[model samples]
Target: MRNMLPAAITAIMSLSVLAACGTAGNESGKPADSGNSSTAPAASSAAGAGGNASIKGKVTFLTNRTDMVDKEYKEYAKRFKEKYPNAEIEFEAVRDYDKTLKVRISSGDFPDIVLVPTIPNADLPKYFAPLDDLGLNDKIYFKDYKATGGKTYGIASGASTVGIVYNKKAFQAAGITAIPKTLDELYAAMDKLKAKGIVPLASNFKDKWPLQSWVYDLPPAIAGTANVANDRIKSDAPYTLDGAYAKSFGILKNLHQKGYLEPDINSTNWEQSKKDVASGKFAMYLLGNWVINQVIENGAKSEDIGFFPMPYDNSGKINSPLNPDWFYAVNKNSKNAETAKAFVKWMIEDSGFDKFAGFIPVLKDKQPELAQLTEFKSFNPTFIEGVPDNDQAIATQNKAQIDPPAMVQDFVLGDGKAVFDKFNKQWADAKKSLGY
Candidate 1:
């Protein structure tokens, strides 16, 4: 079992612009102008006067981070009890959380606080209570991640930048003096590592999602936009031979064809990948900073590991794509909606939980001191926002059977051309169904 949950940004030059409250972005990174203004009653911030009186009941906080159950949450629970002595909070942590959260929502038994459900933001009114008036909108780092219909639906728990996590010792052994600034250098460095009898990159293709992550990793560098997916949606043939989408996949194919990825990628495991990368058995893994602690926890010295943005093409400066991790939202159906909001507010504004978890705080002035993110601090790379799927597009995608992750797996295992051709057809059909 992969003990570490794969945590899943915007382009802002200044941290203030990054923290500004605004309209939410659709699944394609386009502004959600659905024209549906939120008429739902605004839930007052629990920090306001007389708010504590309504916050005494038990509030169930749900998250996918089972690893934090004994480590972080226990400490948080203790601190929360000190503040709200009468109120009780319980955590519901589980594996395969995205699927399970949907199951719970479908059953109408969802918890009070939801952590990054796979559901669309437009549909948030159905499941999560609004948090627009909580005074947290301007304080958050990624406004678009949870904004919908001009209302903030969820509060970002923390922030992270996607980059190439690697072993410094392995780089040294491979005679790599400086970090690669281009894809050519990266591939060359991988070749050197392979020659030194080290696994160049831990593909973790067997895990499916890791392989599927190329969609996230390659685009910011290739398209030079956070709204890459949305751009693809607008272009009739975004996956054409000369397009950035095709270029991104071509890089993946090159990596595999050159044997820079693990020899038997289909059998590779993520849990073991952490240990191997940490131990210098493997050189690198393209992942988010959220997995840095997991790599350290799996038995390697923190100093041994480092992170750098993916150097796709010959771009002089690496464009690091920043993103918010799990977002905490209050469930609309919760009996203790106010209390749940209070708990979430405490966690976001007061608890200082993000700092302890090695996360970049969502607040504007806050900066992540995480060792892996140290390299990016001075780089001043552009922060790219991720495109989110809208309800209609999501419904169309479901009907079209366009599974990018599964398609990625098929590309590697079977025929690449055939797989992408099917994908292009499905995506077109889905778009047509939505009258796009």
Candidate 2:
């Protein structure tokens, strides 16, 4: 992951203008605007072939952003239609995206363009079309995440980093003068906040999914390597007392055991937690920077919210995982593949959707201008890009029936070391059975 950052940085420094427009050629040796002209004539060929073909067809897009379907998405479709008068873009938004999409995929009723779900990387070719012809392989971050056999499948929509989204007003009210730089300092600040009757951290533990921040997201930072998941594949005893999993889970255990979390852990509400955290009832959330805008939208003043890397340990040096969010891909069976590919390109390059969604842009040449990201960078922390999990890694996890978030919930309720030991046994047995 570190190896990829320097090249991306060089690309960013060399760009005088954003790659959204102009004649700059990407790593594929094709111009950024090659097939993106609004007035170009429509072509019957797919857009992946050098991206010179103008797209015109009816294409269906499946998105998890149900909140934006009516307003923002409508505008996107309208603007896309204006660019290609003969084309039509339809969005099918689902509230339970992963579950619904999985069923749809099994029934062969999926849309043209869809967000890639939690599926094995090796199965990418079976469901999604190769996007190599789009000419974005080297131009975009996480280009290799869904690629196989030299053909790329999914293109990441955007990226985000894990951090502490805190309320500045709450911090001031608690008399905390500085941002916590170490685990001990963080605990001290949380104590101060707790004394002031603030829920020091909103552990949305009941939601199950948000708990992934500790197990899935923060482990990479704690291990100081993007290859944490891959590394686990090589060892049967991945969950040890001294390993990253134990340390990451240990922090959550400490938070819960010390009464620093919400009053009602099991009955916590995700939506209301946002409102509570925004209003300063909850002082902080160890979450991604993506939540900052949502918190502000929930009623917090924009200036009242601040972001910083989670000081998981007393290292005095911070490392955060710069991970990609959902990936956008074209359905392999789509009849309107060209239009789908064209829409994906437009969404990634011209739509400005990443900014609207408060995400770091996926294009290496385009740097995020978000205020929270600026504040996060102010600490001079190292940004570790995430590595994609291989097939064996995913298989081992599934075989062991290891759900990190569920394990965390159990850890909070029971013994942390015992939970880790149980999972370690299961993982070792699974690995031996699979002959890994």
Candidate 3:
């Protein structure tokens, strides 16, 4: 594993010069070129201009999250209402989204607008509407979501970049300055903090997905490159496992053996994990930009925290992968497709919505009210910044496994563990209670 860091650099995604208007990376924490309209055509098309009339319809929103405190979908509905007065928004929140959606869609009680966290399945035509024919996919160059050029299903609603969120206060206490650039340095710092009795990685395996990220996150190693995310998805191919991923998991297993994770990762839930980390129980955690908003809501000072990309290698290159991570889809049987589409369009291009939403918009030219109080901008490092590698292959493997269907739902509710329990339960379908 001595050459692990250097040799792996040639395996990660190559750095692309990020422009505000360019669509290069997946949900990687790269800076985009900025400047565009303040509003969408339905609302803030040219800024400071109001449309004369509003269209009306009742659009049902099928969502994975049911938490009103989160306010992501509600912010969407509110902005949509402001833009279109005549439209009525009815939201149907699914507590156990996987089981619920399948049953409801089967029953034919479909919503007008639907939001999918990530659909690993490429056969979206059987489920969602083709945005290409609708003309939405025509003008936009999305990094993922293509079966055929003409059969584009949905456009991603909000994009959030994932990074290693570390507490500055925690770093200062250890008298260790600077974010770790290599795996060895990261572990060394973690050991230092551990000696001081501080947990290194605040983790909750009860949710399962967060930790599963260790398995799915590093495709550059498995795919042998980082840029081919979409190609792998479009191909009728089998999953492959090897390389950098092998090294990455070996690292995770060592962490588990070293007790760097929680006391019992199998039982640690996300709620307790988040509380512990925010209270400084852990030194660092791999978090998405969504955690920024969560921190604010939880009463943490923005300056007390900082974020950086996860660097698996020693050369200080940041992994900026462009993933269609959080996607919103329109129901194929929606009577309010036009209104639903209008709402989605407005959310992406609207500065007002972006300010509150705190996510990167998918539109080419957008006026994003991004927070500058954070150092995330200078923090965008390309793993290719120092190493050279064609990352397209890695990107392809990423898109394929990162959002696999069997992986997502099964782990979320312990369905995965149940199904994997015994050969006798092998044929048992991953089904939910009628109440869920």
- Candidate No. with top lDDT: 2
Task: Write down the TM-score for model 2.
Answer: 0.85
Question: In candidate 1, what are the lDDT values of residues 112-169, reduced to their tens digit?
Answer: 9988566656777778888876776755566556668877777777766677888899
lDDT of 2 by residue, 1-436 (tens): 1112334643442343223222211112112332233433223255533334357779999997765677677878987787667679999987656657867886878999999876677888889998877767767778887778888898888777889999999999999999999999999999999999999999999877788788767888898887887788788788778888778888988998899999879999887998999899999999887777678767887778888989998989998877788889999999888888878877887776666656767876575645776677678677776767667777677678777788888877887788888988988888888788
Better of 1 and 2 by lDDT: 2
Compute the lDDT of residue 53 as modeled in candidate 3.
Answer: 44
Kindly list the per-residue Cα lDDT of model 3 for residues 208-322, writing each as its tens digit: 5565345444544334344333333233332222334335555655666687777676677665565566666776776555555444444445556566676676765656433
The residue pairs that clash in candidate 1, if any, are 9-385, 10-384, 10-385, 27-387, 27-388, 27-389
The runs of at least 3 residues in candidate 3 whose Cα sits more than 4 Å from the true structure, single-residue gaps closed, are 1-54, 68-76, 95-108, 117-122, 132-151, 221-224, 227-242, 315-318, 351-357, 367-380, 383-436
Q: Which stretches of model 1 miss by more than 4 angstroms?
A: 1-47, 51-53, 235-238, 315-317, 377-380, 385-392
Estimate the lDDT of model 3. 0.50
Candidate 1 backbone clash number: 6
Ranking by lDDT: 2, 1, 3
- Greater TM-score among 2 and 3 belongs to 2
* Residue 389 miss distance in model 3 (angstroms): 21
Question: What are the Cα lDDT values of the candidates?
Answer: 0.68, 0.77, 0.50
